[model samples]
Every structure is written in structure tokens, then in C-alpha cells.
Target chain A: MKINTTNYEEYFLLYIDNELSTEQKTAVENFIEANPSYQKEFELLKQTFLTPEHIEFEDKVLLYRLEDMEAKLPSTFKQSLYRNEAKVIEGYFNTTLKRSIASVAAIVILIFGYNLMPTTGKQNIQNQLANNTGLPIIKNESSVSVSANSTQNRIAQNEVPKIAQNNTKPSKTLPSIAAEKADNTPPVVINESIANSAGQHVNNENEMRASPSANNTTVITAVNEKITSNETSIVAEAKEAFENINTDNPDRTIYIANMEIDGDKLRGFTRRIGAFIKRNKTEKEK
Target chain B: MTDKDFNNCVDAYSDGVYRFIVKNLGHEADAQDIVQSAFEKLWVNRAKVETEKAKSYLFTIAYHQMIDHIRKDKRNNTTDNFEEVKSNVNISANGELKQILLKAINELNPTQKSLVLLKDYEGYSYQEIGEIMDLSESQVKVYLHRARLILKEKLVHLEKMRA
Candidate 1:
């Protein structure tokens, strides 16, 4: 800056602040020397700069943290609980893994328990099957052949004689059902419910004779149909139970040594959490 | 910063920071409280703070706290009388120029006063003062220069009246 009457103050301020280089400092000094009146202004400005006061913060000791406070403070609550901190904090990951395994096992138990529960509906089905002479053949073809009042399934290699004895007893309506079968018409659906209301058919044309012997034959036929339908329901329920377990070998529903959790959501959650734990462990090790 | 470095900071900078605060506050207890708080912050952030920057960091925290304290307690302590100060400066011996200068400093507002304090008392550069007070370098220079001119007027007035 050209140091003169109008702008000497700026230069003087910068001069005192030591912002000016040697060349600028020399120029300012020469200008001040040339002008005696501005020298007093410069002197008075210099007096404005404050002097340092010697004062001390006496409580410096209060702010000191030379030692780790955590080391000094005993774990009073942990000690009172009579638990080792190391034992509690460590092995927590292993405990979590064990818990996941245990949970999966618990899930397995819950599934089997629910599937195998002897529900009254299923008990009726089992009782019906047991009454018919326990054989897998009856379960294989769930529907009976209504046209001949004969079961549709092949005769069991062992139980054919028992079924033959039951079939030999002729019913009065058997001839009429056989005549419909010979004509290739659909066999009539029978209803012999204890509810007389339900015994009424929506299609009245195919209604059967209501003689007492005909009624007995109708009741027996309806019972077999029920067992047939119920057995189908049991097959479906068993299939659902097997589907819950991971069966790489479809024959095996569950094997403790080769168990694989099937639910995608549960598997993904466990995998992410396991990966997170493994990452943390690796980072800590590093 | 290490524990040794922090202790070293306390020994070295506590006096300078206390002096800076008490001068601004005009109250010993408040200054003591502010100085302690600044050091406490230094201790808490010792890991982040380095030994080289601890002094400026402490002063920065202390200066801000002082400003807040002063704003909260406006002219509450040591309320100055300009007329009384003028009269006293007029009559006082030339030996007491430092005392007269201090009174002149008290006449300035907080920002201007801090500029003067940081510039003259601690010998901080305009850049360093800007960092402490969160001002631009040019702003510090302009504000400080204006404050210095006011002080100069006061001192010059006294000088002319004395003659």
C-alpha cells in the first residue's frame, strides 16, 4: 500500500500485526520517519495491544485422569452374583450355536408331536381300519367300488379269504346295483346318516328302497366310503409331516446325524448371524 | 496424547487459559469454573488431541465457554463506570499505563475484547485467533484493528488531557 495520510492506519495495523514482509516493513518505517505527526498515532496504536496477565487455574489436579478408572472400579454387581466374568462373557457364541441346534431339535419335536397326536378324528379312522382287518391294501386304494359294493383295491395276498366271506352275504339291492353296473351307468351315491334330514337326497330320482335290509346294506356301504375318504385325509397329513423335515433321502423323514433344516427363512437367518459371528471372531483374532 | 503429555499440558497452559478467562469474565470463581471445564474437555479428548495442539484446543473451548457464560451473565460482575474509568485514567500516574490499558480493554465488547486478548495476551496470530473464535482471518484482522483503534482513541484522549 502507498502509505499516506488517508491509508497509513491500515499499513500501521498490518505493520504491528507483523503481516507485512521485510520490503513492506522497510517502506512503512521510512514513511513513519518522514512524517513525525503520524509517529504519535503509531505509538498510541501500539499502546492498544494488551499486556499478558500471569494467572493460573488452581484446580488442575481435579481434571487429571492418570490411571484407568475402569481398572480401579471393582465389578461389585458381577462379584455379588457369584459369576466369573470370563465364564459369562466368553463361550457366549458357542452357547448361541448350541441354542440354535437345540431350537431346531425342539422344532423337530414340535412337528412330530403335532403330527402324531392321536386326534379323535384320526382315532376314528384308525379304529375303522383296525376293524376291517389291519392291512396296507385297504390304505392303498381309499375309495371302494360302489357298483359291485366291492372294494376297488386288489385283494391282499394274506386277507383275501376274510373279504370273500363278507362278500358272500347277498343284499336285496345288490341285483339292482349290479344291473346299473351292467348298463355302464355311474354307481349310486348312498347316504345312510343317523340324521334322517341328511338321508334325504338332493337328486331324488336315484333314491334307494327304504326297507330295513336295504337300510342295513346302505349303512355298511356309507361306513366304508367314510373310511375310504378318511384314509385319503390321513395320507395327505402324513405327506405334509414328511415334507417339513429335510429328506435328501425321501425314505428317511428324520435322522439326527444327517439333519438339514428345511425352512429357507430360518436357514438364511442362522447363516447371516453365523457369518456375522465368524467375521467378528476373525477381526478380533487379527 | 499420553497421560504424561496431558499432565504437561495442565502444568503449561492452565495459567495462560485461566488468565485469559478471568480477564474476560472479571470474576475469579466463574473463571475458575470455566478453566476447569476446558481442562476436563482436554482430558476427555486427550486421545484425539495432540500435545502440540492442546494449548489452542483448550483456549478455543475456554473462549467459547467464556462467551456463553458472559452472554448468560451479562455485565453481572464488575460493571465498569466509563466516567469513573476516564477520571481515574486521567489522574493515574504514567507508571500505571498497563492498568489504564486493561481498563480500556474492558471498554470493548466480547468479540472485540477476545480479538485484543488473543492477539496481545496470548500472542496468537490472526489465523489462530480465527480458529479459536470461529472467525475468518480477514474478519479477525478487521475486528481487531477496529478494537485497537478504539483503545488508541482512549489512550490518546488521556495523553492529550494529561498535557
Candidate 2:
């Protein structure tokens, strides 16, 4: 704590290096002045401070990575920098062409999905009757032994009377807490099926059509308004286009871009065009 | 760190590092090599190092490389202490205190020289000098104080002999 003859060097070093606080520095100053003999030693210690030399590193260029940093355009990707009217128009046309092709492909897929998907009401009821194991087989006098393959036909003949008479017992009343669990499964929208069957109602017997192999599920029928106006318009356009292209003879082969050709060869030419467009599209993607 | 950050490091700390090395090693080419090696190491490890710590990081690297260079040179060749320096550089009766101080600093061991350089030249605190030289803070203070005393003794000895 005291700066004296013995411990004074450490205090002097701290003072010269500016490590001492103001109070300690003042104390050190007083101590040095009190003993003039130590003043010369402090002065020599102060002289030990090394003056900085200004030596510039000349080849700092070697340390720089000029090749690593390329002048990059900002992230906004300034589209205006690429201004070209003809290219823009070409891009628009290309996008429209791709959309048209996509629309045609979607229509073809929908047609296939529609054909494979929905069950007619009578057919689904027959399937349900054949599948529901809880319902014992009614081998009445009107029927004999039923094989697995003809189970649907046998169910149709026997179950028709019970179902058509509206004698299907209502679903058993479950606990009040779980009363709605009967419909807990997602609602199965039979809108497209009902739409296609016209007058025959697949919506009515939806609950009764649970095949035995199908999981124990309650079918809820709800009308779906999923088709948008754009989709309807695309379908209509596809229909109009289809009708125009499909004709009985060359005279009736609706205008092929105003070029007349044998109707037979038109199919092959269209196929080739489709193949070429598909090939070019895949190449561009790559 | 990005390339831009690394280049900024080179621009900012290269001169300080080069100056420290050259003054201690007393050879421009070897000091340049040591400084270049430090920068190259910083470049490789830029990602792990923060930009805020770049100056200390550079100094730490250059200090060690300079030490290694000195060690290798000591092994391969003989070295001269302050007496040899005094024998060679005779001023007309101790003319320049600056020359005497410079020669005296060069006479210090590598660690002592680095302690003085980081302390006075770079204005580093005792703690910071310790980090650069891998010494403890207390050790840095003791060693640096010892080095300054040696420099002072040299100056006083030379002046007395000449006087």
C-alpha cells in the first residue's frame, strides 16, 4: 500500500505504464518527490517506452482475395436492367403455351380419375352388404349358397327388400359425450359421383355401402364446391377445342390452323408435335 | 468471415503486424514472410474468428510466427546479444538516445521484445499483451517490467561508458 524504497519499483512501473489509479499516481508522485534519489530511476524507466515505427506492409495486395469477390448485382435482381420488349413478349407467349399444354394434360388426367373413382349407389350398397360381417348372410328360400365372387349379386337380391323399404335401423345411440363420434371421420364428398350419376343417388345410401374389408368407417356425404370458375372455363375451352378437332372426315375436320390435311395423318403429326415439345421442354429444364 | 471482411483485416492490421515483426527480427524479408504467414492463417480461420477480434488475432498470430522464426534462426545460426550490438554500433559518444534505445530493444529476448512491442508500440494493456503472447496477465506485467528495466540499464550503461 505504501510506496517506499523497497516496493517503489513496481509502483513506478505501474505509474509509467499508466496502470495506476489517479490516487495511487498522486501517491507515487509524492513519494518520488520526497526522495529525489528515486526520481532519476523513474525517468530512466519512462525512457524505456518503445516509440512506434511506421513501417508499411507494401505487398498487402497478396493478402487480398480479388478473385474471391466478384462485383455482384444487388439481391433485388433489377429486372429493368434486362429491358427487352421482344424477349418479354416471347416469354409471355411461351408461358401461355405451357399453361395450355398443362391444362390439356390436367383434363386427360381428370377424365381417367373420374372413370376409376366413384361407385354407383346400387353397386356401393351391394358391395357394403357383401362386406359388412355383422350382418349375417340371409340364405332365404330365394337364394342358395353364395361364393365370394358373386357375393355382391347375392346381397343385391336379398338386401334390396330391407334397404328399399327404409328398414335400416338408425345408428345406435352412443354416449352423450361421444354422440358425434359416429361422424368423426372426415366427410367423404361424393359431389363428382352424384354429379355424374344424374338421377341415381349415390348420396343417400353412402352410409350403408361400407365393404367388410374397408375399415369400420362412417361415410358422411357433403356437396363440394371445389371447382373454380377458371377450372370450369378451362374445361369448357378444352371441350370446345376437342369438338373442333374431332371430325368424321377431312371436310369436317375443323380448321387445323387453317391448313387442310388428311384427317388420318393429323393424329400422327399431332403426336410428333407433342413428342417434340416434350423433348424440348425436358432439355430446357436440364 | 466473408472475403470482404478478410480483405478489410489485411488492410487494417498488415502494417502493424509487419512493423512489429521487422523491428523485432531486424530483417525485412524474414519479417515479411512471418507477417504473410500470419495473414494467411487468419484467412484460413476467418470463419471462426470475429471481425472485432481481428487485430488481436493478427497480432497473436504474427507474434508466434515471429517467435518461431527466431527459434529456427537460433538453431540454424548464431545470435548476438546486446553486448555484440554495443560492440558493433558505436555512436560518437552516445549521440542518439533513440539509436541506443532501438539497439537495446533488439537486444531483448523474443518474448521480452514482443511484450515491449505489444505494450508500448501497440498500446496494449498488460492483459492484452498476455493474450497475444500466451502469458498470464501477472506474468506479462512482471516480464514487461523486467524488459523495461533492462532497456533502461543498457541506456544508462552506454551513456556512462561514453561520458
lDDT of 2: 0.61
lDDT of candidates 1 onward, in order: 0.61, 0.61
Give the candidate number with the greatest DockQ: 1
| lDDT, candidate 1, A1-286, per-residue tens | 5788899999999888777899999998999899988898888887776656555566777766585542553578657768554644454457677567667656655654543443433444334444544222122212222212232111111122222233323322222222222222112321112112122221121232223343544644554444335344543443343344332322213344676444433445545655666666686698
Which lDDT tens digits does candidate 2 get at residues B1-163?
7788889988888988887877777777787788888888988788899999989999998888878877888898855434543453222333388777887888788889888888777888988888888999999999989998899999899989999
Q: Name the lDDT of candidate 1.
A: 0.61
Interface RMSD of each: 5.1, 4.9
After the best TM-score superposition of candidate 2, give how far the Cα of residue A160 lies from its true spot, in angstroms: 88
- For all candidates, state DockQ relative to the true structure: 0.44, 0.34
Candidate 1 chain A, poorest ten consecutive residues by summed lDDT:
A194-203
Of the native A-B interface contacts, what share survives in model 1? 0.69
